[model samples]
Target: MTVQFERRTDRPDAEGRCTIHLRAYFEGQRLRLVTREKCLASEWQTDKQRFRRSKQGYQDANDYLDSLAARVQAAYRQLRTSGIEHTPEELKAALAPPAPAEKPKPEPARMLVVLFDEYRTAQSARGMRFNTLKTLNTSRNLVAEFAAKLPKGLTLAAYDMAIHDRLLGFLRHEKKLAQNSIWKVVKHIKAMLAYLNRDRGMPLAVEPKQLKAEWVDVDKVYLTAAELATLEAAKLPVGLVRTRDAFLFCCYTGLRYSDLAELREGNLHDWSGARVLRLTQAKTRTSVSIYLTGTASALLDKYLGEGLRLLQVMANQVMNRNLKEISKRAGLRELVEVGDYRNGQDGQATGAQV
Candidate 1:
């Protein structure tokens, strides 16, 4: 019945570290706990705390301990109410088939480490992006870390949707994760399920398909002709003129930046009349056969001749920066703020600039 969190602020690191610990005592010893460190230097900007690989802080540490207490308390309550006291390890042993009559050939248990490796290999074969793969590995590491805080038998896979909802709800509400971010975690869960079912040959882990993607009403805003013209005329950084053109090419072609980056000379259809670009989109695998529009054609004519990278557009950050400003200048039903609804390319008012 005891659930508690303790915080200890110490000057262990230059940034002022806080040890936030949450532990549950089920049978005298701590059953489960979570501890995290954060930096106080920046007034605890959460994204900064997360994204920056900086030092830890006392307040953030205390906060982590508090959250861990809450989660362990919830988990403990559910176990008590449902009468599910056996750890997954104990349950596994309980569910294990009886010692066979003739002493069957021994097959060792599949270690979690082995399961994780197979999961990564399978994901690689299935075409996961490097970053996506990296995120999955991180999630797996987090799960392992959290499980270790519990007993040896904490089976996350055995948890039902109720637990999933509890975890995600706490993550979104108490932890203040955006819906999109929770969905990012959901993606990791899905990857783990894939590893479990397809790779590990396990059954009845949390079903990911039952989980919905976080809803977001998108306001698609591509540049308009006048806006594009204005953007084209805008001052450039040291070497970003080509990058702008390349992004513009994507705007016209509906190709993602990934597809745009990988397009090669070999894919360029020179044999066609008047410089048509023939290529399949990297993301959707949809083939695009755009027969040179006047401006887009001119861009290809210039860049293809020089043999420069189609993506030499310094970076996507610059593209987004310029686009945001350009949208504001064009005044699309008022300047496009971060969350404002703006018309997408499909239907634009006659004078509307992006």
Candidate 2:
């Protein structure tokens, strides 16, 4: 049940890599592995693949490596108890850390809080979306929570893969998060690690990857032509009819919900003194031109509200609810099913799904 450590240089196919940092070889075999910080976000310690970098990541990496060392040793002991070949190298490599980088280079001293700000600014410059940035912000909070419990002067680098995996695993398993949701948190951590590597030149022991989870189907109303007609015929609630018209406008113009909600007056023009609706979608930021349908023309001509926009985008949710109700009242529910069952995956941008 004995587990002995080796310098990676002592192992075959792993000589002078310096990246292996730590190892557990069995009776002269590459039994298993443990890792120390070789670079920022690089953890060579555990079976899990990724480790994000932090300013004071070494402290964390060491603690992680130590825990893994214990686990590998125990597993070898268990094999002996079970009468298996307790080869250190074989078992150890199986439990070895994920990766390695160059040793931690020299760096300027700075607070974790300060480095976090730097990371944020750097990622933002990388053209990250707001939602993505928000997730990173959340991951940052989780790190803070863990950091808070540590003694003063403790740096985040003082942690390792075991602790990082524990927290991330909780987010994935306990939170029961979807791929997209988990991706957000992990991406943020990875971004910070990247910053530490490039800016501070810290070597990491792990490279974080996307969660490699699956996306799910969205239950949604895609909209349809017949449903549009039913909507037109059905008697409607007062302002909701306008909202319905706006959503219909979305269907035809392909404006994102945001653009439809925020469209201003100046974006439109007159064709021979007649109104023409034109605006750019906020989501994709693409400009759109729509020759108003007769009904749409009427809504605009009749209720060209003081603002340049046709409908206030603020009330979109209420509008969708009312529109759905209008559809049900007009008996368009069947149409939604018909459109989907008919076209299957071929239904993108079709008026049938809405």
Candidate 3:
């Protein structure tokens, strides 16, 4: 087998650049293919199969030709090693490397906010619930604030133990967030990483499991029977009547604000001389049968009777604000202590009232 180079002066371009080609001869057959390199005819050495040393860029052009010849020789050696009979065309084609693929343009540098936007878009497409989306937005805002303080900014591919530890420290020591709240932020970061690596095709440095969610059980504050009675009987302002009624309704029916918002007169059915709520929970999408207490029954009768609109529930934000005011008016101002699990240690917060 023999590989040879030829300069085609007949096809010289306007700039006097001659096309170079490779020829293979084996077993009385010949194969030829054009190489993409171009050089001045005077600079090319047909006999030496390389560019002349005296010409500009001679070293690089000559080295390219040498490597091309070496690849052809290597192909021939490989065929001989395989003990297979092959034609000159097969050997020449084998020697020709496939053209390098055009690389995609480098993406603009991504920040935490950019990825968070993309994540939220994808979640919206998946039909995430409003509350769930709100939670993610809250977490992302905190993440963005934390990322802004970082030296080089947050990158999808740069997440590691150092970033994780620093973020936790920021939330715990600087922000004074509970461990469970920090866990929520970490969960959001994990989801963002998953979207980057799996959906956006970015290579991430850390695994999802590396950002393990550490949760601490927290004792929630609930209105006691006495406190609830005080709230129910307390003369609230005209603006807080709906809020007071809704709070008492929740206490009696054990329904979430979301489920309570979805309640309608149609959902209240008569059963065995008493009223029962039969409705599909908005959060869980599961049907529940709640036997209404006398208070719940009376509230339902007053608000959702005949063709009246479902309980006159206010916006969640408004409801929370009014509830705080009502609680203060009702003199339910005992300092509450909450326990948390932080960094595998027991932590407690005292004199926290809201």
Candidate 4:
């Protein structure tokens, strides 16, 4: 048998670096194994079977090739001394690095829960809102539950469309959630996976197209002009008065809850005898100028002397609950189906309200 270092000229890496292999010839058969050294073909010496001392890593490559050659020769001598006949494949196997101690496959990477926790921490540090964070936590919990059901559990390497398809089926049949709600979960999953891959330098197993969420068309409901007047004239209880006023102001000026909560007297201006509120949207950070209606102007007048926050904004849950009561008291029981178009209202408006 004969073993020699041969440069592989046909296959080159992305950087045009060619690898050298130990080619074994015996009994009309040949076998080859990579030597884990790479360089330009021009930097190699054909007769010397080593890299020339011309490149940055040439010395280390030469030493490694020498060590590999010694191992192959030792394997050949050992087989002959033992009076055993071996094929080229057997010699190559004998020269291999003792089967690498058979590592336990690296424990199958980390659990998805760990990555989700890190993502939540980073998001909180970046000032995500409480409601948005809460929704993401819900999604993360669902993902954890899904992972627990699997035999191998979840890891970044196992995030593929198969898992996604199964999760969609679980959300639909097992959790009995509608497409819209399931879409929310998928949205959070896509965002978190993107953060891990693009932001945190983790590799994802699935393509971006595989992670796409299906959009749903939702029916929106709005208060008609008559309902608006009823809400304005309704004598709400002391608790709902703030929420009622805020809701009415939103209906008039089309200000989002985030922008309205942060609105102050400083945002109000007299633009050629017209009262206008100028501020940047908290969600998008875009500048906005809202001309006030008569009711909007009156509502601002009521809260003008308030502190840094122009209005008394309650927790989202409290505000939503109180608005439901306000709707009942306004006697606008008619189911009003509204479109998704904002016209000039808040950009995030998409749902229906009575």
Task: Tell me the TM-score of each prediction against the true structure.
Answer: 0.45, 0.41, 0.57, 0.54
lDDT of 3 by residue, 198-306 (tens): 8878877788779876776565575678987898889888899888887788778867776676677788888999988898766566788999888788887677553
lDDT of each: 0.55, 0.56, 0.76, 0.77
Which residue window of length 10 is worst by lDDT in model 2?
335-344
lDDT tens digits by residue: candidate 4, 1-354: 677998888999998889888887767877688877888877889998888888688877778887877777788789879887777767867876665566566545967777988898899999997657876898898888888899989887888888889988888898776677688888888888888889978888886557766767654556778888888899978888998888788778767676676787789899988898899776566788988878788987787777677778876546766776777887877643212224454233322345
Between the candidate structures 1 and 4, which one is better when assessed by TM-score? 4
Indicate whether candidate 2 or candidate 4 has the larger TM-score: 4
Tens digits of per-residue lDDT, candidate 2, 193-305, equal 67787777866555544323343444555446765666667777775666666666666554555556566767768887666777754434456677765666665565577
Backbone clashes for every candidate come to: 4, 56, 0, 3
C-alpha RMSD for every candidate: 27.9, 24.4, 9.9, 17.0
Give candidate 3 misplaced runs (Cα > 4 Å): 1-104, 124-131, 144-155, 158-176, 220-222, 301-309, 312-322, 334-353
By summed lDDT, the worst window of 10 consecutive residues in model 3 runs over: 335-344
Ranking by TM-score: 3, 4, 1, 2
Deviating ranges (above 4 Å) for candidate 2? 1-206, 216-221, 232-243, 280-288, 299-303, 306-309, 315-354
> Worst ten-residue run, lDDT, model 4?
337-346
Tell me how candidate 1 scores on lDDT.
0.55
